[model samples]
Target: MTKKYAIIDTGGKQLRVEPGRFYDIHPFTSMGLNFLKPNTKISLCRVLLICEGSNINLGHPWIRNAIVRGRVLHPCFDKKKIIAKIDSKHKTRKELGYRQNLIRFIVDSIWSNGKELVS
Candidate 1:
């Protein structure tokens, strides 16, 4: 059997996802989905494309009735990013650090057209 995978849009970004794998993603704040508790079930419906073996399915913007289900692992902070600015002529230096909040989840299943693919 062929493994199924999909491309999905989340938090203004596109991600290629596969079932049974864990991924970190930016929380959807507009939908009030930040800081979700661990083990919570989440469903992503903005499927851009789906591929299985030699067959492929595409969406105009998003495929209707296509869903990817996952289980939340935890809320965590991403790696720190540092920015430094220096003006040697003036003997001035500035630095800044930033880290983004993210949620980790493991994909459980992909469903479309009444068919379910579980990893």
Candidate 2:
């Protein structure tokens, strides 16, 4: 059987999510990061689109009453990147590192068009 899925945008990034799967995503908002601890469950209402066996619902930006229920699996840091630059003639060198703050989530259910599907 084919499972349904949805596309969602959070923290300025787009993600394809399916039920019963875990995805590491950016914190939904800057301030929301401060209060959301691990194991907290949240309802994401920013559903861009939903598809189930070719039955698709397109939204004008987002669908009304479409929500994805997920649990915060953990709060962690994402990948780290190192940037380095060197100038041979001027004898200048610079190095910098960047890491993104993120949260891991387990999708529990998808509610679309007044119907709920368990993941």
- TM-scores for all candidates: the values are 0.91, 0.90
> What is candidate 1's TM-score against the reference?
0.91
lDDT of each: 0.89, 0.87
Q: Which regions of candidate 1 fall more than 4 Å away from where they truly are? A: 31-35
Q: What is the lDDT of residue 46 in candidate 2?
A: 90
Look at candidate 1 and tell me the lDDT of residue 14. 93
Pairs of colliding residues, candidate 1: none
Top-TM-score structure, candidate number:
1
Q: Which candidate number has the best lDDT?
A: 1
Per-residue lDDT tens digits for candidate 2, residues 21-78, read 9999888654477777888988889999998876888899999999999899888898
Worst lDDT 10-window in candidate 1: 28-37
State how far residue 91 of model 2 sits from its true place (Å).
1.2
Error of 1 at 74 (Å): 0.2
